[model samples]
Target: MTTASGGMTTEQLREHVATTLTRGRERTAALIEVEPDELTAQHSTLMSPLVWDYAHIGNQEELWLVRDVGGRDPVRQDIDQMYDAFLNTRASRVALPLLDPTEARDYVRTVRDKVFEVLERSPLAGRRLEEGGFAFGMVAQHEQQHAETMLATHQLRAGAAVLHAPRPPAAVVRLAPEVVVPAGEFVMGTSTEPWALDNERPAHTRNVDGFAIDTAPVTNGRWLQFLLDGGYDRPELWTTVGWAHRVQAGLTAPEFWQLDGDAWSRRAFGVLEPLVDDEPVVHVCFHEAQAYARWAGRRLPTEVEWEKAARHDPATGRSRRWPWGDEDPTAEHANLGQRHLRPAPVGAYPAGASALGVHQLAGDVWEWCDSGFTPHPGFEVFPYEEYSKVFFGGDYAVLRGGSFGTDEVAARGTFRNWDHPVRRQIFTGLRTARDLTAAERG
Candidate 1:
């Protein structure tokens, strides 16, 4: 093994690649370990069957690592289009000649074994994709992303509680209602991250005027107040598009929430429990979050503002890799990697706070930003264009920070996630921000 790109030796890169792949597999197993094969069937039209995602993960590894990177013969060339996401829609995928659960497990195992063999021999430095071991990292991140998708399907599936984990730690610090971020220029994306995908590339300087953003995400308790105040009923609080969508969808509260008499409860992985006041609200769509921000006389932060708050260190005037620092995330930093079933209570993970005093910026729930999805200044299509180039438009709203379901490999300060604004199935939430008054900025 020798040094290649990103200043890391091939041995170090290989370890990282192996560790990431192993963790992704472990997570996939945990999500489906006890569920019967029938449970893996198409649970929602919005998402592919668990079995499809299962084999797709393996298929991608075989395509990229085993075949492309290693120059090996195809393992299952017949099923290439069967698992091609661009070729098949999620709703229609159930009708495809998909692999059974047993077959899926075996196929993934076989592909992974081949991958390991290739990984050991490859220099991981020659081609563009091999530079910095990007392909390996990309595949690992892809699997983790699918794992999170599977977790979402599990949440949508109806059943008694099948998943359990310890509750996130209680809040250790009391944060202010809002923090003022002075007007300034900050780097918004990543140019140096070896594993960062195309949309996050070509880091650029962005100048944002002074604004005051919520110290933490909007909480369920505050949302309860909005609901009680007829927030949904008040069309004035919602944009014309949002109000129309709300009416059509009949969205009265966050997904999984249930009301009984005077109290509210939420369903988590099949268990119904009283909603906690302090935990950040999850499963809310961009429309819901935007409406709530409007009702509160604020708005969701732009993607740039979100990144600045999560990465900027005031003293050094530089962006840190994460809110806590450039160091890799640990359990102490934030709630991530399915370590918990839900978001941590607000004010938790004070150690995860950025230099500007922001908290929970790394994980908990995906926070919706006001910005629409687009490319950076110097964006270019890489290994493939379908991964991000197809989604570069205003149709998709951006979300920053990872969720409790997100793995560290797929979550970083500069990482970008975007989806249709009406989507609520993802683990999504929001934190509000407002422009500073003249006196305040002065």
Candidate 2:
């Protein structure tokens, strides 16, 4: 049976959609101002031309809300062909007949206006979005996700940084090496989160063995040790496929780093500076994370282990929505929502610690887990399968925790982010774990 999470009214949902939609628009507008030419430029094959993102957001709103739910006429049926992501490759998108920036903005405005009308008329109580105002929440989160993607394009773009957000505060204290999570059964995923996407649905029990995980993310200084120790040159430390790719890509360091003689620096946004020693390492692929763990005599946590460490309250046998409990995230909880341009230092947020005292489980960076992307036992695709189902069972790795680019409204301890094992442009990081047995040891 599909049931809705309680405690929110339709009016509250309405206002939330209005507010969040505006925020996404403001961010998108500010991003285009970086350099009009850059927005149209395809910075990398990994991302679409900026103008495509602009129109695609509006087109999605039209497809899901105005036309699909409201039974309204299409806003710009002709242009839908040009913006379909599944049909158009990122490389191919740049040459498509995309709308100009001015036309794109107008399209987004018109679609949002129609969507608000649909929200007003629809009874948000029968199914899907109606079941829990989920559609509205989904739309808001979608736009925010795109905004983060656009920020990635900005990072890859050549020019002065168009994006500007304060860096998170420095770490003030040291982290304990690891936190021990006692073995037991714990609930995973959720059936009650109003805005949860389909892949995270149908909360269920999972039995995880006892393990110890890092109390904080691996810092740049700590990762530097792996590099200095020749971790990359040792094929024995990396998987055969990973070793092959490492040599192919010339993977000496994280994506944005540059080694100069005896010194090291990395590019953040538009400027290059010496690496912050205490900050969590970002932009590392899973292969690199796996290699570092081997060098350090540890391992990456499995996705289930990752969740139990971050969510299981042994005292109550219940999971928290976030590391700090059932409450939603705030500025004090973690570094998120693009509020910062970079990860905070390793031990930055004591207040955000999990029940077991594991810190930084909520944000700063999305931590890679040692699991491939898959589905829950009772999974059912809602809205569409393309969002999550299509990506299942691929050569993808699951990443837990949100990132500095993550919008808190879209993040929860149960939330999931997945990508190819070789992706490094994302705000990705790692925290080492180890099995509580001898044979598992390397």
Candidate 3:
């Protein structure tokens, strides 16, 4: 095997690939520790059955690693079409003949067993996909993404709670209301990250005007204030399309939330709990976030401004891989990997703060940005175009930072996630930003 760049020897690359894939499997397994019926049942039209996701993760692995990279025949040629995401929409998937929970477990284990053999023998060099174990890395990230999706499904599931984790650490320090990001250029996206997806590629420079961003994400307490002030009742706070969506959906508050007499309670993973005032609010769509921002005399930061706050370090004038630094994430850095069932309270994870003193930029709730989903300056289609290319358009709103359910492998500084502006099913929240005043800019 040829020596790989980035100082990763062939052995280290192989180990990393194995570890990444393993973490994904572990999370997927934990999420599906439910009844067989639940595994096959559709929790919501917005997501797939847990069992379908179970085998689909393996099918993708087989297609990319075992067949495409290793030059092997299909393991289950007949089942490929059923698992193709584009071939069948989520709403139609439940009607298809999907593998049973037992069958899915066996098939995925069989495919994974073969995949490891391929990983051990295949050279980690040559073709772009093989170099640095990109295929394996991609597969690992794919599975982790689905794992996060499954976690969201869990949240949507109704019943006694089946998933649990210890609470996230308490707030370590008091945070300022907002941080001033100076006017200047900061690197955006990634040119060096080995596993970065296509949308995060071709690092470029962006010069943004001075702006003030919330030091932490907007919290339940603040959202309560918005509610009390009749923020949703006021149509002027919403955009044309946003107002329409709000009216059609009757969106008076974030999803899963209900007024419990005089207090607000939200359902999470089948458990009902009173609103935690200090926790960053989740299950809010871009419209609600935008409306809330408007009510607060602010707006969501553009993707450029959000990236600059999360990545730019004025002291060194370089963008690190994460808000904290180049180091991989740990328990102390962020509340990731389903470590907590919900977002930690605001001001938590001070260690995860960006160089600009923006707290919780890596994990908690995905922070909605003002920008629509768009390609960077030099975007290119990778291994496949379906991953990102198909989603490029103004219909989607860009969300930065990873949610608590997101895995470290799939969540990073340059990692860009977008969904329809009306989507609130996945864990999402926002922080507000505004242009610096003339005096403040000076």
Clashing pairs in 1: none
lDDT of 3 by residue, 40-95 (tens): 99999999999998899999999999899989988898999999999999989999
> Residue 151 in model 1: shift from native, Å?
0.3
Error of 3 at 282 (Å): 0.2
Best by lDDT: 3
Ranking by lDDT: 3, 1, 2
Top candidate by TM-score: 3
lDDT of 1 at 196: 86
- Which RMSD values do the candidates have, in order? 1.8, 2.6, 1.8
lDDT of 3: 0.91
> In what order do the candidates fall by TM-score, top score first?
3, 1, 2
- What value of lDDT does candidate 1 attain over all alpha carbons? 0.90
Q: Residue pairs in steric clash, candidate 3?
A: none
- Candidate 3 local Cα displacement, residue 389, angstroms: 1.2
lDDT of 2 at 5: 38
Summarize candidate 1's per-residue lDDT along 1-442 as a digit string, tens digits.
1111455677978887888889999988777675555445788899888888889999999999999999999999989999999999999999998988888889989999999998898887768788788898899999999999989998988878788899999999999999889989888888888788999888889898889999999999999999999999999999899999999999999999999878999999999999999999999999999999998999999998999988888798888888888888899998999999999999889889988998899889999999999999999988798999988985999999999999988888999999999999999999999999989988
